[model samples]
Target: MKKLYFVHLLNDYSGSPRVLNQTITALRQQGNDCTLFVGSSGHGVLDELDVATHTFTYKRFDNRWLTLLAYVWSQVALFFALVWRVRPEAVVLVNTMLPFGAALAARLRGAKVVYHVHETSIRPAALKSFLRRVIACCASKVIYVSKYLQVQEGIAGVPAVTVYNGLSEAFQRQAMATAYQPVRKGRFNVLMLASLKAYKGVNEFVALAAALAEDPLLKFTLVLNASQREVDEYFASRSVPCNLEIYPASSNVASFYGDASLVLNLSHVDGWIETFGLTILEAMSFGIPTIVPPVGGPIELVCDGVEGYQIDALNHELLVRTVVRLSKDSQLCQALSERARAKASEFSTANFQKKIVMVFDEL
Candidate 1:
């Protein structure tokens, strides 16, 4: 069995971290030795895993100097510690930016470095791009979550692979069993599940809600896990339509899928036109149609008039018209939901693990 070490700078339970946890579990089940390194202050989703854990003094921040300094120090300590303890054969780094330090350390200790790309979008800063290009050149292998992301980033050559995100069987079963309930008392239920970040277009959702306020039949709800403080502050600053409700992010995401008539994701800039479309997949698994902007990730997942509609832009008029049409056509909704569920099955966890193991064996 080959020894593999996975390093994650932060341990928050985001999509990337969840995927990391799933990958580690899959690797361990195949009899490979796996270890996880995480930040001392952050909480990891992999606590249940039986792998060895190493803590480092690191933090996630936009401040480049502080972040880099912490990473350098932590990696230095980790390298010496691992040298005398468990000398891994290979190392997988989670994020592109933070992996440079770890990769350098691993190389010094004679270990192969695999860089995983989870950041779908890049900042417009020139310095950031330069740093990323330097790291990309040093990686032995690059893994992208979506092909669209690779193309968008202009990452050519160097043996790159696309591995989409996977959903667990439990999540799939919950989605398949979920039944959509009609709006009571002429109220239409629409949900936006995303973090309260600027790119996620929560403000656009708010604008859409405001535009739909004239219609007594429409009600909106936002299920946000990250940026709770930002969302709360935004809500406190403005007068949202009475029909709109902002729900905090919940672990019981299945219920959120079950309760909504439609799911919405309107990102301003996405790497892949909806690379894996996890939320859209979840909504589809629950047999609900979704609406997304005609941009990255969503375009790839939503089939225009089939599974879902893509807005021309974040225009209120376009979203209002689309939602009205879908809400009125029950047959259309049913057809789309059926097709979406079928599509979601392609990204099951079993299939994901099988593909990953196959790739590892080939390597």
Candidate 2:
């Protein structure tokens, strides 16, 4: 059996790691020998899987300079360790552009390197350029999560393919079982799941909630991918509206989806373009209509006036109007819900598995 090394910088309960976990499961089911090299930062979805694991010290910091220093140090250490660890003819799969050390080591050790590109909005323009240059020089093949990302970041000569992210079978099964029930009556819940960052539109969501606070029945929920302490610190100076509720990071979001009348991804396009909205897809699986950013990967998933509406996160007036319209119009919401579920079926776990395996095999 051929050896495959999967390297990811952080193993948090985030989109990239979750996608990597699903990919590893698929590859292992096909009888491939898979080994994972991840950071010892926090517990993650990858922990559920039983596999051979190697961890390196890495952690996020509150100070920007400290964080940058730690990240560069981790890469330097990872380069030497990966050079010694990876054997000839083995395939190295780097989860994101941040972990360029794996690609360098793979190229130096005479192994093939494949990158699964997930995000395009990395801070510090020079760092982003450096990582792109690494991909150009070292990667043998590239996999982009969305066509929008491929168009935005595709290298001139590097081979690439676009694979839409998929919902895990377990998540699909749960959504299918829960969505068949009657929609909750009385209160209307507008939900947004994202990291606790300004670019992610946490401020916009809070503003929307404040704008619609006059209607007591309309509620807003924000599930952030951060700890409770982090959430508290982020909101220390800001006043939270009564209708809006905030929650820390969680793996189980089925209950939120089940209770939601509408889902929203309010990413600020200028600051951060959402390459693909995983939370929007999860909402679709639950037969809930979504409001996502007008640009980037979300447009491919949702059609305006169909599965959901695509509106700019900065447009507060339009967002308020849309929320009021969806809250009052029950029939329209039901119609969109059915279409949303159907659109979600096109990007299934089975399809993701088949496409990913084909990419690896061809490489």
Candidate 3:
């Protein structure tokens, strides 16, 4: 059995943590010893994992200076701890580019370091450059979540592989039980599940809701990956339409998918490109059609006219037209749903587990 060490910066109900949760669980089932190093500030999806967890205190702040200081300090602490405790036989798998200290520690102790890259749109151009340099200098192998990410952030000499994200069996079962059904008439719900960030197209979603408010049957739901207090504070100065319902982070998204006629991902390509869209796959598992950004990993999940249309979030007219077209024509919606369900079955957890385990075994 292999001894594996996993490190991630945040433990929020976001994409990276959820992916890490799946990786750790799958690896442990293969009889490998797993250890996790993560932040203790957020109580999220990673909390339920059955493995040895070592947490460090770290919190994010609005001020860039304070956030940078906290991040640097966490890495310093992690470096010392790992240097003292890590065995030479262990392989350290850093989840994102943020936890470079793990790579450094592993290299110092003669352990191998693998980078599972998921994002390319890191803020502050200088930091992004520095992180890539760290990966080039320290990582022995690189695993990218999507083909697009591999091309965007790949280093020239590093060995790289692409592994698409997969949906959990529980998620598939829940979707099948709750959402696989005939389309309802008279009420159409358009859903967008994302974090409460401006670049996530929160304003665009609200605008779309307002534009369609005259139609009594049309409604919009925005689920943010944040606490209730954060949700309230974010919309304090903004105007929310009557047809739009904004909610905080939720663990149970099957209910929303069940009620949804269509789902969307409106992240801006320039500000924050989506590395891999797990929510799009989740919606597809429910046979729910989606509209996602035209660029990045989301394009891989959704073909322009096959499963769903690819449109830029900044194009307000196109967004409205697509939503209206889907709303008015049930035949088109059903066709897309059928194709979407078929497409979703191609990304299975069993396949993902087998392939990812093979990578670990080879390492």
Q: Rank the candidates by lDDT, best first.
A: 2, 3, 1
lDDT of 2: 0.90
Estimate every model's Cα lDDT from 0 to 1.
0.70, 0.90, 0.88
- Total clashes in model 3, counting residue pairs 3 or more apart in sequence or in different chains: 0
- Which is the better candidate, 1 or 3, if ranked by lDDT? 3
Question: Which whole-number lDDT from 0 to 100 does residue 90 have in model 3?
Answer: 90
Global CA lDDT of candidate 1, please? 0.70
What is the TM-score of candidate 1?
Answer: 0.86
TM-score of each: 0.86, 0.98, 0.97
Clashing pairs in 1: 272-297, 273-296, 273-297, 273-298, 274-296, 274-297
Worst 10 residues of 3 by lDDT: 177-186
Q: Write the per-residue lDDT of candidate 3 for residues 1-363, one digit (tens) a residue.
A: 998999998888888888888888899999999999997678888988988999876788878889988998888888887888888889999999988788899999999899988887777888889989989988889989999999988899999999888877788778767644334556888999998888999989999999999988788999999999999988999888999998888878778898888999999988989988999998998899999999999988999989999999999999999998888888888899999998999888887888789788888
lDDT-better candidate, 2 vs 3: 2
Please, what are the lDDT tens digits per residue for candidate 2 over residues 130-233?
99999999998999999999999999899999999999998998888876222366788999999889989999999999999999779889999999999999
lDDT of 2 at 217: 73
Query: Where is model 1 more than 4 Å wrong at Cα?
Result: 41-44, 47-50, 60-88, 95-97, 181-186, 227-230, 270-275
Pairs of residues at least 3 apart in sequence or in different chains that clash in candidate 2:
none
